[model samples]
Target: MALFGIRRLLTILLIIIRFRLDQLIDVTRLPSWLCILLRFGPWRLVPAPQHNRGARLRLALEALGPVFIKFGQQLSTRRDLLPDDVADELAKLQDQVPPFSNEQARTLIESALGKPVEELFGHFETQPLASASVAQVHAATLNNGQQVVVKVIRPDIQRTIEKDIRLLYSIARLVQHYLPDGRRLRPVEVVEDYELTILDELDLQREGANTSQLRRNFADSDLLYVPEVYWDYTRRNVLVMERIEGIPVTDVAALNAQNTDMKRLAERGVEIFFTQVFRDSFFHADMHPGNIFVSRKHPERPQYIAIDCAIIGSLSDSDQYYLARNLLAIFQRNYREVAELHIECGWVPPHTRVREFESAIRSVCEPVFEKPLAEISFGQLLVYLFSTARRFEMEVQPSLVLLQKTLLNIEGLGRQLYPELNLWDTAKPFLEHWLRDRYSPQSMFKRVSHRLPGWLEQLPNLPEQLLEGPRRPIEMPVPNTDIEHLERQLQQEKRSYRWRVLGIVLIGASLMQAELAHWSPHTLALGALGLLVLALK
Candidate 1:
């Protein structure tokens, strides 16, 4: 099967070359003659012909099977990876792939619950409300007259994904060997990340847990609503959750009908994003229109209803803190601090030129500074930052890319609903207040108080671990044998910590360069902390 998959891939590659896709991709990095050979090689599958290249590419990926479809889905998020036209076309490929039969869905749900369909719900629609590469959702209702929705994983999607993933690995190996940009793109690594995400999405149980947690996060707030996950009816392949009725966030006319405060709605969108990113660090990574709805109950104070919790994101604790700091710095036009923070956070190299980065940031940000706060574009700022960091060899962060994409989608939707939306102004207060509370003395006291029990419990063990770090037992191996092995392990662990510290420093510097000088103190403090961690080792 593996051999056959590769054979089919080779055939597809032959066709692509025959059609001059090799030339379509940037060839400046490859030798001219080699590029020509790649386009018109001995694998003469077909003569070059005019076609909608983007659609052809999508179709070819589908032919190659689920792995490539998944790959294309991810690549769609990376506007930086492909030409705008291609990326725009690819974005339409979301969850529109062929779906498994309704029979399979019924079978899987029944198997998961160990019961008949009649016992589960009053009605189960044969047609899916929506179908994606991994699963399908159907509208349903309970016997007690409560509306609900059923989500079931596509049958054999796991096998399909696994098979395609192996093929992708093979393709990545070949590309890395032959293509100049392969190493930089890190295709294999990207595939690995996608594999993890796709597999996690297949597990409805995990999705349920994510929804439940997020629901809890916003339980008291009327800003966003997550449906209750009916655990009693949930299983690995199937999930049942409360049905929500609201205007799609993208439906401007409907929102207007409900007298929604468009300005407030737009502002709240920005606040929700920043809050999830900074305060909670867990955000709905997929905030596309199909997965979001606006509550009609509070027309003047519209709230968002979010579903499809399969894709989510979280930052490292330090990232959460520094991101908040960076946002605050950007608003204050603290470019030097931004640069320094970037370096400290390891978003750039520790040795990156701070002055140059700061100057570059100023050039990008200065033009938009005097504009009305509502007119400022956060997405544009991020693009500028990313473009600037490209010079310093900043590797693309997959998780950050997801966040960037989601933010863009949300911002676009908000602007559509309400023109003259000043995203920066709306977000500035939330970010500012979040940071203030985060670093405030009272907040520190609260944190200490919250952890007091755990700290007290560990107090007695601290002395023992520190004083008795390591001891030679009576029957210990000779020093040369075990000591060398132990030393090697410790050295490896130390190296890992060293790289992590270096990364932090680099990010801090980058942030400072981007006009966030206030972050310098925190960066320095973290550097000291990182050094302490190294010393302890």
Candidate 2:
């Protein structure tokens, strides 16, 4: 297995060299590259000179396959780390790839659903509607006379991905060890992240489940629509879902032709983003133009359709609360509040000067305040804040990073559709409303009502546990671990408390001594008694 793994690694390296990726970066120094030429030998180089080194590097990765495309997608989001041109170019990494043979697709569907394609669908197209590196979609009609789309995974992709991931890790390690900018970039960690993302995207069943959960999250609303997953026909590598047809959000001309409310559409995009982050905490991280479409059914009040649920971002409950508060603070232009929230959330170092951080935030935001509220971008505010906070030793929050990136994408799309869209106007109300809902009495009641049954069930055991509190073993000598740790802390606190009490008592004794200077013995005894009481405790 080890020898075959090494051989597989060499094959990927040769592919990389054939595309001339070695010239784009310092590759011979990379162990994977050395492993390649040493085993696979004299490589052929493809001439791609129109693009600069960075662009060529991105293009090469795209050519290498889906896993690399996913890596490029992540790099595109790190605007602070990469140059504008490189990040911009990487953003164009298309997920499109040639589809595998239809016969193979048929076999996969039959194996997963335990039925022949002919029995499963009224009509299944041999040609796919769209093809991505991970999966290809074909329009099909279910046996129940419902229109749907069938998504089938590329054949043997898992083996290919596993081979290349090992090589990627080797290169990432070398970059982190030798490159000056590698530590900040965290290449090895980034590769590991990419590994997880690619592996997740491979599981069509998981993607279907994610789509279903997100659909449930917004089932009552018209803001966004997630296609219904046909669980009866879904499998690890194949998914059957409700087919949706609408103009892509990028098709500005089509949206205009349908008389879509551009202003409302743009404003609602901002609202949906905040609601998903602040309320649901689960957001479709991949909201690029290709995956989003605008509903023509409601041209006056446009709705959004979201697909591609392979990547999602969620915040911890604390992160969600702090993020909402921080956004509210920014909307109010309360820079101090923003700074305080950052410290409270541990976004900044504990010893960071709050005033200094506040001033830094003010400097970044004050210039933007000069513009109309409609013109000011929340995305830009966050970008500047992140840039400033990094100077204060703020660590990156990986979950928030995706939200920030998706925000920028949504903002860009919205502004292009409607330049006068006031993101602040749309978002401020939503944040305030969400805050009220979170802490209101009614909300608290609902929470308790949901948990009361479980609490009541466990209540019977609580008194017995309280009566028999600290459990000890009968067979072994007890270790006073709790007392030992508490004793050290207790001693420090006791010393401080003792000094305070002693100082107050001494002051009282001095006053008594002053008043009874002529007959001091009786007053001195009273003072001694007071001191004794103070010491006894």
lDDT (C-alpha, whole model) for all candidates: 0.76, 0.80
**Candidate 2, residues 18-115: lDDT per residue as tens digits?**
55665554545556856475445554434435767667767777766777887888778876566678888898888878888899999999998999
For candidate 2, the 10 contiguous residues with the lowest summed lDDT are: 465-474
- Tell me the deviation in Å of residue 313 in model 2: 2.0
Question: Each model's TM-score?
Answer: 0.80, 0.79
Instruction: Report the error of model 1 at residue 116, Å.
Output: 1.0
Scored by lDDT, model 2 comes in at 0.80
- Candidate 1 structure quality by residue, lDDT tens digits, 178-224: 67777766678777777888889889999999999899989979899
Residue 1, candidate 1: alpha-carbon lDDT: 81
Would you list the clashing residue pairs of candidate 2?
none
